[model samples]
Target chain A: MTQVAQAMRDKTAVCGVGLTLGNFQDKSALALSVEAYDLALEDAGLERKDVDGLIQLSFGNDYDRFLEAVGTDVRYAYQGWSHGRFIAPMLQQAAMVVASGMAKAVAIVHGRRRRAFGQLADTEMWRQGLGPHGESPAYGAMGPVFGAAIAAQRYFHMYGGSGDDLAPIAMAFRKHAQLNPLACRTSPMTREDYLNSRWIVEPLRLFDCCQNNDGGACLIITSAERARDCKKPPVYISGMQGVHAGPQFHNLTLPGLGVAQQEVFNYRPQKEDLYAYQMAGVTQKDIDFLITYDAFSPLVLFGLERFGFCGPGEAKDFIKDGRIELGGELPINTSGGLLSEGHVVGWNLFIEAIRQLRHECGPRQVKDAEVCQYGSFLGETVIFRR
Target chain B: MEPSYKVVEEKTGRYLPVIYPEELPFWEGARKHEIILQRCNSCAKSWYPIGPACPHCFSMSFKWDRMSGRGTLHNYVVFHKPWTKWFESKVPYAVVQIQLEEGPRLTTNFLDCAVKDIKIGMPVEAVFEDITSDITLVQFRPGKK
Candidate 1:
């Protein structure tokens, strides 16, 4: 590990987390965000004035608007693009701020309404570099699902699997969601139901795609020393890696899947790709549980492969027979992940990691969970320790 | 020959490509039933999504070289859910990514083929569709074996 990465290890920890999922039509996005922020401050046992930093994404409101609503000031603040891929980077930024003394405590917050004013269909897909998720509107290849669908097709073609291979992922998360009261889709989903689900895009069924709903989430990061005195046990930010991008790193697809301009090949994580584990001074075996960005079921497969949890095409077989379930080896997304928990642009996944480390998750908790990871297909990661 | 999908006479609600200033030549090439891409003079490679520099060698020196209009279907998906009115009637249509002989993949629709018949590695040839007086799109169809 680099000296800089070594110094940053476990210096900052998540002191508090707040989340609100499901429809909130009566409340605006800003109001929902403010409520979550208030909950986080209370949960951290810190007054509004105690928080010296603020970070948010561009969905609900601007940073100034949020500060005005909360009536608190901070020394460090930033706003990022409102995409699930950026969530890990936002958390990493907060950790860096606290570690570097830019802020005593930083809160990364988000609130979004489904199909709100800045809808992807209305605007984002029209952006210059193709829709954020490779949405080619001209060909009616619209929505974020198109990106996952195309990647899955390529994966299946290269690795020899079909949409049926994705059933285990959907069924596994749904089982976990049944244990989570806050999960949006908690109903039992059998294999039959998965097969019967209508297709959204070929190789991706309705069940394979995450549901959109109004939600808000927040997580507070502070120096490890200060976090010790907070209301809950500090979930130390042990290691982190930023989102990888380029011709090879497509938005939703893993590197080497050859989506768009990417080169076609089987992707395997070299030493550099697993830098987060190195920074954390641990390996994949040390991870008690994992929480990944599962905007779609195929993303889980990609996430596993990207993080070296399994080989390039082996994730299909690795996720089978209750292996990723609560009682199985390397349980993933125990709080039902974005696939079932609800997508707060992936903030919920981070919150889930924090809760697992704190042992706050009752029925859905992994037994004696000590280490957790929030990894994604785009290669961004955050390794947290209890 | 008439395209299988209905092209509405009223073109108001149709979702057309937002042609960027840099991509005018590619669109103009489509109007003339040809595929044109930026090929690097130094590296001798082509790229997609219309960029200014060569992604392969970082060479700014390049030419808008005309392609053979032939490629292989590298990837595809069928959209069962339509996002717009024009696509509502065209449900279950195949959107493909064709890897050209010169090597960059392009996102486009497939013509003269059913969604089920579309396969990866299938040879496909470019076909032009003049959607409007000012806009012509580059689509693909099954090519010789």
Candidate 2:
């Protein structure tokens, strides 16, 4: 595993970062993808001819439309995230295509008009005849918040968790959002505000949920040799891996089976995150900073544990006052993750990891940061280094 | 007198389950006040959300057996917000997970109880709720102590 990981290490690099449609309105999903793709090419200092591969990172995104809009033919074409979960899996695939000499430059882009279309509830996807269990119609199981709320309740019941323990995780990202101009919610939030926020679902306030925003984020990955000649300093991909800890993610069928299903989600935090880190050969201490996918607040708590930063139930204790804040022992979601920052799915975290690796985040940057890890329970991690 | 077990189709509302061909038998049994689960003939393992074959034995053949209708509350959540207009009246209702004695878990709602009274590890018994003439959604209520 280490040898395989070593083979990919520093072999490919992300040369360009393009974010075009965040917090905007009246923009179509395809338009956002094209805009982000255009900016990525500009940032990489490459044109249509430079991209031999293209990968769509979201559902319903027209690869044909993008191909026509760009007017460029590629030797290789692939679609990532047919389920449209996030970009980690897609990015990992793009890197592999680049590493295997199948493509010189792979352009990966994701676009969403979720807020513009008033589709804030992500669970609605299950209702659109995709999954076997149609949530709202069959059972009143509505959105991601409902599932997250149940998970939080179980965490509280099993681990003795409290809202107070998870408050810092929410506020820390809000603090980081204050420094991020592109973040949707930049206003500073106090602990009182978090507690006072209206409950969307029990144990989860409105603040606990991710903010809906129309956006697109893209990245250009190429061979290390090609990236060295690009405009910006190359940020190396040390390791990347994707692991699914459980069966499917529906509530009606699987329900709380995730807690009981050891094969899908590892009971031990060390084992869960290590499944990815073992390939990269990076430890928790080696990760200077982390960007846990914060679609929900408990996600940070869960991510902290899964990444081996703390014990199974120790995340509630691990995320103490100012511990994950800037200049602390370890900073997380410095770009105001899904909760406070706009939800580009996980793309913002991917872009932020690259920015932090490049030392470009003005105030929110992790000082002297060398290695950064981005991951979530759906189980994918990519360690980026300067 | 006991309530009728017939599932009237016209009475079903917007939240009724859309029964596919494979799920027909489960609903048919629910309409008769019986809880049925698919048990593999080879491995003798039972599973929920019925699949085409046994995950344990990978056998295409299985049996639909009646359950004792008793289980333990694994976990639950009380929805403060409604998902759709149909659920608007059901706000603040607790959605519960029951770990059946047959080794399968079911997502259901509790009847005849307050949301606050629900507890993990508490005993629960399956109860059938006929929403339509052809559809009966299986639910759970507090089991006899």
Candidate 3:
């Protein structure tokens, strides 16, 4: 590991986390964010005055407006657009702010409704370059699901799998959701039920997609020393890597899938792709459980391949026979993931990792969980330790 | 004959591409029934999703050159659910990504092709659709063997 990476390891920890899931049509995004912030402060056993740093994404409120609503101020503040890929970077930035002494504690916050006012729906698809996720609305190629659909089609074409292959991922996460009270779709989903679900896009059923609901989530990051005095055990921010981007790193797809301008090939993670494990002084074997950004089920397969848990095209076989289920070789998305749990813009994925590491997840917890990794298909990752 | 999906009479118009100044040549080429993109003078390569600089060689020096408009269908997906009211009648259509012979991929709709007929590696060619007086979308259809 590099000296910079060594110095950053385990210096900061997620001291507190708060989440609110399910439909809240009456509540505005700002109101939901304020509620989550209050709950986080209470969970951390810290007052609003104790927080001196703030980070947020668009879609809820601007940074200045959020501070005003919370009746507090911070020395360090930042805001980014609301995308699942940015969640890991936001958490990494919070850890850096605390580790670098910019703030004693930093709160990464988010609040979103399913169909909020000013939500970038149709307009985002027509963005100047390519719609974020390669959308071309004139062709009726809209929604983030289009990105997943195209990628899944390419994956199936290149690797030789069908829509039936995705049923296991949906079924596995649904099984995990059965144990999570906050999860949106917990009614038992059988194989027939999965095959019977209507298609949102070919090769992707309605079950492959995540649910849209109003929700809010927050995580408080502070130095490990201060975290020791908090209400819960600190989940140390052991290592991290930023989101990989460019022509090759298409949104919602693994590298070498030839989506957009990407070239077609079998993608394998080289040494640099596995840097987060090195920075944490651990390997895939050390990761007790994993949480990945699963806006769609195809992403779960891509995430596994991106992290080198399996080889290219091997994820189809690797995910079968309950391999990714709760007591399997690698239990992924134990809190049901965004696929089953609810999409809180991926903030809840991190919160799930924190909860699992703390052993506070009563029934859904991984057995003897010590280390967990939040990695995505884009290669953005954050490894946490109890 | 009526379609299966509900059609609203007072429907909001279709979403059109925002024509930026740099992309005027591409839209103009489409209006003239030609497919064009930026070809780098230094690298002698073409790129799509129109950009100022050449992605291959990072060269700002480029020209709007006409393409063969012949490519292989590299990827595609069938959207059964319509995102907007304008696409309600066009449900279960195929949106294909065609890899031009020049090595750049373009995302567009396939014309005069059934969703079941769309397959990877199939030869396809560009066709222009005059959706508006000022805007014409460059689409695709099956090509002769």
Candidate 4:
């Protein structure tokens, strides 16, 4: 609707989905990055020579940092928004580059070994607004979590979702994580254990957030016809859209009531997204599984509502009733979301969606899964025509 | 219980104001502990983080305006997992996004009320916290007489 949609799917296809264990270890972002690059190339049954274009994701990545780490010469180089709202733009650019014959095959990549790399993202400049004329945070609200907390609170009020309801959503993913090899969380999560956890934000508990991990993931996109020769069946970039709204962003107008609600996150606010999902040409009912970006537990529930998988503020009921888990109506985060699987800044979640659609996920795969709709916690909705 | 803050910077000897080269008026108002916004003369649209021109009309016509800071609690949440150590204890604080009467919605911390007292559409007013002698940042508290 308000965000521009993509129109070229029959042309471009994602041929390979590659992800590393993505955890916070001694590995540097660059080393973890190389690991991710190797995985995608090998998985596609190709070599470095097969790639012509490269799209690198940067929230905090320096071009030099990535270029030196991976060590490649490319015909084209591109960057996407680091703050996460511009993923569709990144994919769209990669597709455009390849489809237009700018390059033959494009590798779009994102990764972070945050915990081992540097201090968590808190800086005076970020806390303050950008540009000298900008209005910095009042009382010095310098953390990204501040806006995140605001979004969580709004979802609770609009949906009648309480802390208890939010608790189980994380619990569900934590349970699913046990089956995952790369999952950072090994223990099971119980409701009592969740309630007993310390509070982080009002209504947000300690277990509510995602992990700081060391890993990287990449996708290789080529012409759909050429994709069959390289790797597995291609996951088409069926319907995609990303637009910047809001004054707070240098990319958008100031944060208006509309952009603040949609741009900071579209899926968190149910009212806007329920209407937007209609344009994707499929509804929640059509999706057999999901690969939601669960940076926080409440966020997972908020995503469910935004995707129209359930009614407004009804994600808790959908989750608590076991309707959102394996064999349920919507099997969410089969690869254990950011919380349990570890944060690859949403790339791993994308990998899992492809895995399910390809029926590669053994134990956690949704039975006969066909299509999926993903909620990028950092950006917009992605309906996969896998 | 009351809160305490330490001074970080001082507005000394008139360190250049946001004027001339650019309308550096944002600092001029922030110093007075009042939240200032910009309204475009062409389209009458309100904007924040103050800009060079009206985003709607692309007109540079703008002037300083003050608001009641009264508006609906558009959205909010509580973050407990510590992103940093500086904010470990304030876990239950209501981090809010308020749609100002002037039409600019901002991310802020809601104070002067119990956690449960926070609700959507509740009216709020600005309270500046002068963390530094030179800078005063605008936050919100429950509206009161």
Alpha-carbon lDDT, every model: 0.89, 0.74, 0.90, 0.64
Interface root mean square deviation per prediction? 2.4, 4.2, 2.7, 6.5
Per-residue alpha-carbon lDDT of model 2 for B56-123, expressed as tens digits?
Answer: 77899899999889998887877777766666798888777778888877777888889889998999
Clashes of 4: 28
Query: Of the candidates shown, which would achieve the greatest lDDT relative to the real structure?
Result: 3
Fnat for model 4? Answer: 0.45
lDDT ranking, best first:
3, 1, 2, 4
Task: Put down candidate 1 lDDT per residue, A298-341, tens digits, no spaces.
Answer: 99999999999999899999999999999999899988888998
Candidate 1, residue A286: lDDT: 95
Question: What's each prediction's clash count?
Answer: 0, 8, 0, 28
Look at candidate 1 and tell me the lDDT of residue B38: 94
Residue A345's lDDT within candidate 2 is 68
lDDT of 4 by residue, A1-386 (tens): 43334345446777876788744466666666667778888888878878888887764466556766667777888876454445556766777787789988888777676644343343333322332112223333434444444455555555466677777678778878888887888688888888988776555677876757677788888887777787687776655544433443332112221335233433334445343245456666787887766777766765565555665556668787666678776788987788888877777777888777888877886888777777643336666776
Ranking by DockQ: 1, 3, 2, 4
Worst lDDT run of 10 residues, candidate 4 chain A, spans A250-259
Give the range where candidate 2 chain A is weakest over 10 consecutive residues by summed lDDT: A253-262
Spell out the clash pairs found in candidate 2. A245-A264, A245-A265, A246-A264, B7-B132, B7-B133, B8-B132, B8-B133, B9-B133
Q: Which model, 3 or 4, shows the larger TM-score?
A: 3
Model 4 whole-model lDDT (C-alpha atoms)? 0.64
The residue pairs found clashing in candidate 3 are none
